[model samples]
Target: MFARDSRLRQWLGQWLPKRPVTRRDSPATARGGQGDVDRVRRQYLESEQRFRALLESLPKVAVQGYDRDRRVIYWNEASTRLYGYSSDEAQGELLEDLIIPDAMRDGVIAAHRAWIHESVEIPAGELELRHQSGELVPVFSHHVMLNEHTDEPLMFCVDVDLSDQKRAHRDLEFATRFDRLTHLPNRQTFEADLDEVLDGCRRRGLGLALLYLDIDRFVEINDALGYEEGDRLLIELSRRLSEQLRATDLMSRVSGDEFVLAFPGVHREDDVMRVLHKVQEVFRRPFGLEGHKRSITASLGICLFPDNGAGARELIRNADVAKNQAKLEGRGGLRFFHQHLHDDLVRQHRLAESLERALDNNELFLHYQPQVSAASGRIENLEALLRWEPLPGQPVSPQEFIPVAERSGLIHRLGDWVMEETCRQRAQWRDAGVKLERIDINFSGRQMGRHDVFERLEAHLRRYRLGPREIGIELTENVLIEADARILEGLHSLHHRGFRIAIDDFGTGYSSLSYLKQFPVTSLKIDRSFVRDAPGQPEDRAIMEAAVFIGHRLGLEVVAEGVENAEQLALVRDIHCDLVQGFYFYRPMPADAIERLLVGGVQSLGSLSN
Candidate 1:
C-alpha cells in the first residue's frame, strides 16, 4: 500500500510541475516531464489546504479512532471544544481515561474488551466525561470496530449534556405520579405499579400481596383540629409510614386518608401478617401536632396474588371488600380476603340492582306510625317509614336494605320517592278533611350530604302543591358526626324554607352538646334502646332524664320512641316528654288504616292488637 501511494504521488508530481510559466508554454515545449510533476504537486498542496480549513471551520464534533488494544489513533476538534483538551493533549490518552468516571473505569474496560473480542458495534450508552475544569458531565458514547485484518477498533463518542433534560423529566414524573403534600406516590402511579408487579408475579410464579388501608375517623380529626393541623398530621404520618416500611415495599396514597401497599415476593401468610403487625405498631404511637396529642388507627385488608385475584382490578376490589368488612367489624382491625366476602359483595351488587328496579316497579310503600302528644293523648303527627316488598316470598327488613341503599347510591332515589309520597299523602288527607299536622320522613346521612337536596325538596313540594311547613326531615346523630359544612348549610336552608328538622336516634352516637346547640333542630327523639329499658334500668332512666333535660335546655321538644308499656309512658310523661310513640300507641299501619284510625279515634285497630 505504501509503494502504491508513493508511485501515485510521483506520477502526480510529474504531470503538474511547479513553474512561473502559464499557457504561453505548450505542454510539449515546457520543461519536459519535470514541469508536469511540479504543476501536479502545486495543485495537490492547494486541495489539501482547502480540506484542512473546511474540517477546522465546521462545528466542534469529535471523531476518534482506537486500535483493538484500545490505543487512541485520532481525535477531532470537537473533542477539544467539548472536553477543554486540544488534539495534542488527547493523542496519547486512553479512551477510557477521557470518558469513563473513576468509579466505572473497571466496567468500561471490561465492556471494551468484550466488544474487541466480539467485533461488534457498541452503540451510544451512558457515560460520564470529566472536563478539564474538573466538572463531570453526563454523556452518551458510541464505540465501533473498524478494521478486520489487525483487530483494530475505531471508536467515535458524541457527548450530549443531559443535566437539564434529566431535571425536567424528574420534575414532570413527580408532578404526574406523586402527592404534593405527602410526597407519596399517587393513585395513578399506584395502579400502574400494582399492574406491573402483578404481571411479573404471574410470569415468574412469585407471590404478591396488596394491603388497602384507610385511616379511621380521619374526618373527625380534620374537623376537630382545623385543616392546617390535619395536613401537618397527615404529612407526619406519611413520613413515619415510609420510615417503618422496608426499602423494597411500595406505598402510595390512593385517596384521602387511604393508602395501598404492594408487597412483592411475600410467599407465606405469616410474612404478610408480620408486615401488617409492624404497620399497626407504627400507627399505634400517638402523634403530637401543635400541642395536641392525637392517635389514629387503620383498618387494613389484604389480598394475595393468584389466591384472591390475578389482575389489578380484581385484587383491588377484593382488598376493598375486605377493608369494608374490617370497618364493619369495627375499627383498628385487619381482614383477609375470603370466599364469604366475595359472596357478600355479589349479594350486595344484586341487591343494589334489584333496588333500582324496585323504584320503577312501584314496589316501595310507606307506613305511618302515629305520634301522640303526651299532654293531650291525641295523635299530633305521623312518622312516614319506608317498606320494600320484594317479589313473592321475599320479605326484607329496612335494617338490611337501608344500608345497602345508602352504599349503592340508591338513597337519593329512595329519598325522593319518600318525599313525594309523603307530600302527596298529606295533600290527600287535607283534601279529604282529615286534619294531619305534619309528616316526618327519615333522611340518610348520604342524602343529607348531597348538595342538590334543597332543590329536590323544593321541586317535590311544588309537585304536590303542599306547604313546606307540613313536611319534616329526620336525621340521626351519624349525620351530625359527618359534620360537613355543606350539610349544615343545607339544613339551614331547609329551616329557612319552613321545614322542621328533627334529630332521630339521639344519644345513640357521639353527640356533642356544644355542636348540637348550633344546629337548627326543632325536636330530639330518644333512641329506642334507651326507651326500651326506661323506668326499669337505672342507667336507661338516667340517660332518658339527661336527654330530656338537654332537649328542654336547648328549647327543643323531646319525643320518646319505643314506649311499649304504661310504666314507660308514665315515666316519659313525668320527665315532661312532649310526644310519645311505640307499640303502646300503635304499630306502623298502612296509610288507609291510619286514615281510618284518624277518623274513628283508635277503635279500628282491634284486628292488629298485640
Candidate 2:
C-alpha cells in the first residue's frame, strides 16, 4: 500500500506538482521547491520596484492614501513636490490634522464617512492644506474610497494646486461686487449685504438701520464740469464716507450720485441721527478737485428695522421713499420713514403706470397757442403745447404727466407723436391756404438725448410732406444740461437739415449765454417766470434787457413768452423782442379754431395787444 501510495504521489507530482514526491521524498522535494519560490519572489520584488520608480518619476499629480481612520498610509514623491513635504514626513499622519482646517474638520470627517458608507464619489473640490512651511496652499482634491475586500475602507486622493484658480475667482468676485470708480461696494453688493444683514437681524432679534443718501446738485456739477472731475469728487466723497462709517457699517454706491448705508446693531434712533450728523459735517467741508473748490450736500433718509419693515427689500423701499420726500421737501436735509411717504410712493407709482399707457390710449393731445409777431401783431407761427386729456373721471396735468413721461422713458415716444401731429396740422393749414410760417413743437430733455432724433424728425417731415423750414423745435435749458455728445450731434444734424432750433424757457439754466454761442440756436424764448414780473420787478427788467441784448449780439431772434398785459407787452417791445406768445394774445385753441383765424388774417381776429 505504501509503495502504491508513493507511486501515486510520484505520478501526481509528475502530472501536477512537476516533482518526485514520496512521503519523505515529498518533504525533500518541498525543500527543493523553496529555491524556485525564492526566484519567483525576487522577480516580483524587482517588478514592483520598477513600478514604484515609474510612479515616482511621473510628474502628472500628487497622490496619497489614507485608512478609514484618515491616517495616511501612502504618500508619493509627487506629494512632496506639490505640497512641500516629503513622502516619509507625510506618511502615518492624520489626514484631518494635515489638510483640514480646525473649523472644517467635522465636515471633512462627515464627508469621508458618507463616501465610505454610501460608496459615493466625492468629486474634485477646493481644500486648504498646511504645508511643511506652515503656509496654507489651496488645492483641488479628488477623493474616493477603495473597498478592496468590500469590508475595511481606504481613501485614495489626488490633489492639484488651485492657488491660481482660487485667486482668479476671488478677483472676479471682487470686480463684480465693487465699483472701480469709487472703489466702494456697488449696487449688487449693497443688495447682497442688505439681505444678509436683514436675515441676521431677524434671526438674532437685533436692530438694523438703512440710510439712503443722494448728492444734491450732482447733475448740475456733472453738466457744468465734466465726468472725470465728477468721478474724482465721488471717489473723494467715498473715502470720506468710509472714514466716517463704523466697522460694522457698509456703504455702497447704488447709482450715479446715490449711496446706501447699512448699519447693523443700530438699536436706537439717536445712533442714526449721529451718523447722519457726521455725514452732513463731513460733506459740508469743501472738496478741492482740479483747481476747483466745491462744496456738496446730501439728502439722507432713514428706515429702521422691525419698525418700518420686516425685510431687506421692504426696508430699502421705505428708505427710498423717505429720501424722495427729503428731496421734495427740500434737498440737503434728512427725513425718517413715515407711513404717508409710502402712500405718496404708491400714488406716484400708479400715476407713472397710468402715464405709460396714456399715449397708447390716445389720451394725449396738443393745444396750439398763437405765436404773433411783436412788430406786426400778426399770427405767423403756432407753438404746439402737450396736453394730457385722461379718460373719463381722470385728468392728468402736463406738469404731472410730463415729468412722469420723462422718468418712465416714454417721453421719446410722446415727443415723436407731438411732432407728427404738429406737422400734420401744419400741412393741413398750408393746404387750406392759412399761410402758417412755422409750427413750433416742444422737445423734452429726453428727446434731445435720443440718438435717432434727427432721423425721426426727418421721417415725420416727409410723412407730412412738409418742408424742414416750416417746422421749429423748441428745447428747454435742461436739454443742454443733459449735454450728451449725441444730443449735440442730433441738434447739429437738424440744423443742417434746415430745421430751426429755439432755446425755450431760456435763462433758467446754467450758462445760457455760453450755450447760445456753442449751439446753433436760431431763437431764444425768455422764460415766462421772468416775464410774469417784468413790468414791476427791476431785476426782471434788467435780466430781460441783458437777454435781449445778448440775443441781438448773437444774432438770435428773441421771443418773449407770458405777456399777460399791455404793460408787459410794452416792456417786451421796449426790449426789442422779436416775437411774443401768451394768454394775452390768445389762449391755446383747437387746430380748426386756429385755422379759421389764420385763413381770415389779423383783421378777422380780435386785437392781440389786449
Candidate 3:
C-alpha cells in the first residue's frame, strides 16, 4: 500500500509546474533552494495521503462526486460497496442512468440542473436508490456543493443506508402499542383508536358502544396459581376474545385483567347487548392450564355514544363506572351506564374527602360490640368497630366509608389510628377495673401488605403498655388467602408473640378450606347472613353446624356473628357456638356504656331480655 501511495504521488507530481530557481550566487545558495522545493513536495504528498485515508475510513457512508454535466467524476470504495458496482464502473457514468430509479430519474436531473444553472443548493433527506443488482436501497443523502472560484460547480453526495435504523424504529413502535403478555393492543393504542373511531362516528352519524370488562377474583386466582399461570390465563383469554370479535370491533387490555372493547356502527342497544353477551360466554369454558382447570367469570359494563357522553374519555369513564357497579352487584353480570352512577361517583368523592379529615377532627371513634360465650353468656371479648360521625350531615356507615378509605389510600392511616385507639381504650378499661379476655380489632387488607405495619403495631403496643395477647387481629378470608410472603411472615411473628389471629366474615371469599391450614389463624367467625335465618332455613342451620364442626376439628374457636333474636341465639347455643355478637346482646355503644356494662358484671349483661 505504501509503495502504491508513493508511486501515485510521483505520477501526480510529474504534472505539477516547477518553480524557477534564482541565479545561484554560490553552491551553498543553490543547495538551499533545492531543499526548500523538496520540503514543499513532501508536505503536499503527506496532505494528499491524509485526505485519501479519511475517505477510506468512512466505510458506511458512500461518497460520489459529479460534474456540471451530471456525469460521475469520482467514486470512493464505499460507493462501490453500497451500490454493488466497482469504483471504475461507477466513475464516468451518469448518476441518473446508474443508480437513480426510473421514476426518480427525471426529478434527479431537474434538481441537478437547478443546482448547476440557478446555483440553488439541493436539500438533504432520505430517498431510495437502486443498487447494481436492481434492488431498492433506502439511504439518507446529504449534498455538498463546491465552486472554489471556478465556472463549473461540483456536487458531492454522501449517502448512509437506513435499513438497521428503520428496523429498530419499527420494533420500538410495535412494543409500545401491544401488551407483552397477551400481544393485544395496550391502553395507549386503545385510547388512540377510540379517539379516531369516535371522530368518525360523529361525522357519519353512527352510534358506538364501549364495553369494559374485569375478571372476577383474578387476584385470588393469581395468588393461588402463581404469576406464570396467571399470565398464561391472560394469553388464553385474549385469544378467545379476539376469536369472538367482529371486523369492526377492537379490543385492548387496559389493566391487569381488565379489557375494553369498542364496537362502532351499532344501530341499537340490542346490537351492543348481543356482543357483550357473547363476551360473557367466552368466560364460561374453563381455562386448561398446566393440568388444572380454572373457572373464570367476568363483569362487563356498557356505554353508548351520545347517551353516555360523546367524548372517548367520558365514555370510558362511564363504562368503568358501570363495570364496577356490575362487580358490586355480583360477577357474571352486565350493567349499562346511567345518570345515577354519576351521582354515586360524586357522593363517593365527597365521602372520600370527608374521611381524610375524620381522624384529625375527632369525628372518628370506635364502638365496642360484645361477643359473649354462648354457653355461659359471659362476655368474652369486645370487638372494636370503627364508626365515623363527620362535622355535618348524617354519619357514614363503615360499610360505606371503609371502601372509600381503601380506594383513597387513607386506610393505612385510619387503620393505624384505630389500632392505637383500641389498645389505649383497652388499657384505660383495665385500669378502671373493667376487664375481658382480649380486645379484638379488625385489620384492613391494606395494612397486612405493608411491611412496616409490624413496627407500627409494636410501637402502639408499647405506648399502651400492653402485651400482644391483649389484642386479637381479625382479618377477612380474602386477606388471609392473598397474603404475600412478607405479610405471612409478619402474621407468623405476631402469632408466635401470643397475638391470636381470627378470620372475620368467613365463607364469603375464596372459601378455600385450605386457607384454614395456610394462615396462622386460631378462630373463625361465621358471617351474619347464615345466622340471621338459621332456624327457619335448614340450609343455613346446616352451614352453621358444619362451620362449628370444622372449627372444632381444626381446634379453632367458632364465633357466630349477628344473632339478632332469641331464636338465633338459642340456635347458635344449641350448636355449641363459642361466642355470639349482635344487636340482640347490645348494640355497639360508646366507651362509657361499655365501661358501665363491664362494671355491672356478667349477670347484669345476662338479664338484658327485660
Question: Residue 105 deviation, candidate 2, in Å?
Answer: 13
Q: In terms of TM-score, which candidate is strongest?
A: 3
List model 2 lDDT by residue over 1-610, tens digit each. 0011334234322322122222444677787877767776676666667656755775646667789888898788878876776778778888878766677778778777767676445555667776777778887676645552467666667677677788899988989999878878888788888888788888899998889999998887888788888898899888998998888888898889988888898859688777777888888789986687877888889999889998767888899889987886666978899988898667777887777677779887888898777877788688998887668647677887777678778888888898889888888877877777898888887766777877888898888899877999888876776667877877887788778889898888876467778887889999999999888899999999999999999988899999877788888988899998887788887777777777773342325324
- After TM-score superposition, what is the CA distance of residue 260 in candidate 1 from its true location, in Å? 5.0
Candidate 2: clashing pairs of residues: none
**Cα lDDT for residue 175, model 1?**
85
TM-score of candidate 3 against the unseen true structure: 0.77
Model 2 earns a TM-score of 0.69
> lDDT of each structure?
0.78, 0.79, 0.83
Q: After superposing candidate 1, which stretches have Cα over 4 Å from the reference?
A: 1-88, 91-212, 216-277, 284-296, 302-322, 325-342, 374-377, 391-393, 481-498, 511-518, 535-556, 563-578, 592-603, 606-610
Model 1, TM vs. native: 0.66
> What shift in Å separates residue 284 of candidate 3 from its native position after superposition?
6.4
Query: Which candidate ranks first by lDDT, i.e. highest?
Result: 3
Full ranking by TM-score: 3, 2, 1
Ranking, lDDT, top scorer first:
3, 2, 1
